[model samples]
Target: METRELRYFVAVAEELHFGRAAQRLGMAQPPLSRAIQRLERRLGVTLFDRTNRTIALTEAGTVLLREGRAALDAVAAAERRTRRAVPGRPGLVLVTKAGATGELLSKLLDAYAAEPGAATVDVLLCQPGEQERLLRDGRADVALLHRPFDSTTGLEAEELYTEGQAAVLPAAHPLTDRPHLRTADVAALPGLPLPRWPGPGGTYPPGPGPEVRDHAQLLQLIALGRASAILPDSCRSHLDPGLAAVPVLDAAPVTTVIAWPPHSRSLPLAALIRIALRLGSEHGSAALVRGG
Candidate 1:
């Protein structure tokens, strides 16, 4: 019912031990236990199954954990945005994967700056799988997300452009001579495993490929004949001279979409979205977010 209650419940639910949760919350165990009991009584449902040695969530507790997290995130987003909306300097924060958006970002910024009442756009360049978290937490107002790579679970999106992917490798590699490649062609390259990218939790998937944090690192690995990568074709322009790109004909097209929170109603954000869609309309697909 209250933010404090939710915070206490979340801390307990996550820790599954009042003693540990109390330590994390800088409180004593007895009060935390009583708080949980009171919360359960108020809700008319037992949230956790507790014993002297251990504790676990009931089915209801699990559901509350999921929904409660969303509610907390919503609260955090509200507080963050409100604090940022100080008078005299209205601005919008847009985050994107570093080195991925390239020319489209330049064009979008230029076009949006020309619009009336445009807010100053503060751009945040971040690592892969970071834009969603940034946007969700209200650290960023909008983000350029690539489809099939960045998940858009609860956000709205407008497609700006889509293009086929390319397999980037050393210029001297035998595959560079080919006009295009198949997935198998790229996969079977001797000693050149696809570089493993870290997930949202910052851990790489199990693989023989060297872990890479950004395009530059991946390119360096490729230059050293230590790795290979499949990236959207638009990255071709930024590729180093020692690198070569061959279209992966069977690879899915990467869609660059401008995404924002579903509850966003900012006028400046709307105008900028329009300009992005209008400018990008000429380059590729203009598909809007489905059921947005």
Candidate 2:
């Protein structure tokens, strides 16, 4: 009927003697005997055949012994799994941006995997808008967001690095001859192509535009001299023979931030946040040098 009763039943069943079962359980013989009597009463079955000199299991006792051992084993296994999921143990969720941030997140996650008690990180590649909702709803443990978070109350964000934008152009384009170009320079180019904005209510600044969904297509258009697009410097490293990147002048830097629910500041999550910030900062700095 209860775990304690089942444990008592198991000890008595194993030892086949009330006196020895009481000693094994570290309890008095009278209490142990009464507990087994209550267990038999709850089940409406006789568990033991007892005489003045002998004690042995009845048919019901044999069945109960088998089922009771299985039930106790299951409870033990469940407790083991619960302990493993505790704070300071390994297990984490990372919600991230689509492009460069995603790459950075992957590297940090791999490093955490090698550490002792490191959490199994579930990385969710998400859009900027979904971060607040994910954190609020408990779908994610931490998020890497492009800065200027819309909501700040339920979350804590730490600025990791600032990323500058660059112009992607066809290698032979006239602008490619210059070491870098400004927004005005690209805006002034004749028939300059730009990717279509994909965000909700997304619209690019007034200009000649090509409706493109992702960065790869934007690169393809640049390669064909059909258009030029502006993106973070980290994207510049992905250039091919036909495509080149020129730095954008006087553009605001997009800051990448590490964010987590304010309530989840446990030791393990805090440790993971530190790792993410350090790695992201290092990567952003490296990208700047390489792109430059």
Candidate 3:
């Protein structure tokens, strides 16, 4: 199917309304509806179950939606990468959530730059959950992502290291007196709700807490006693005096990974990945020694 048709199908499938989808696509509803109908006829599958009052995706529609989104992302990535591939476009763009992977990122850059012929590396710090989209859309050449919190679907990645989680709270809060806390204890804290970070579409999930845009904002909120968060223990190194982190025993351990497009062929990017893997392995070994 044409990318245009797939685009239409995805918009409709996501919105679940033809009129809204047409508006989103900046086209007339009649033509948009016809396009979907034509696509359905050509594919010999009823993509949607539409009635007088409501419309929903059939099983095939669900599959197409998922696959179509991926296809569209691939096409966009190809276009962007091609445009940037012209002569003199050197260096790599590395993206990650702002205020995260602090020490590791600095050390990686230092190590890579010390190599004989490392290219310039541009760091693109973004809000939470934006790395995958930036990487897929060719706006970034690599990413440092945390698993279970960040999705690494469709990207090739190397496991950096796994770390436990800790709950960040106001330094003066009663919970800070405890040596450690369980996830349930953090959740059951009175008056302090976990802040909601934006998902892929840049929308916050339904929650009682304030909506946070980045680690800095979330930290500020915690300092003010308005919110709390369970983040990787590595964050403890960066917490301010006004806040404290207690190990959360039952939260899922977060694994850090270095990720890039599966099809990348740049020698510099490969060298960078090698350094990241080496550093990650060494860090894990050091941790094991300390634990032992």
Candidate number achieving the greatest TM-score relative to the actual structure: 1
Q: Write the per-residue lDDT of candidate 1 for residues 78-147, one digit (tens) a residue.
A: 8999999988888999999989878889988998888877889999998889988999999999999999
Highest lDDT scorer: 3
Q: Model 2 residue 9 lDDT?
A: 95
TM-score against truth, every candidate: 0.93, 0.59, 0.86
Residue 163 of model 2, lDDT score: 80
State the C-alpha lDDT per candidate. 0.89, 0.75, 0.91
Minimum summed lDDT over a 10-residue window in model 1 is located at 283-292
State the lDDT of candidate 3 residue by residue for 118-138, as single tens digits: 889999999988887899888
Query: Which ranking of candidates, highest TM-score first?
Result: 1, 3, 2
Counting only residues 3 or more apart in sequence or on different chains, how many pairs clash (N, Cα, C under 3 Å) in candidate 1? 0
160-278 per-residue lDDT for model 2 (tens digits): 78887888888888777887778888877787756565455544445458876555666777788888877777676568898888888866677777877664546668878778778
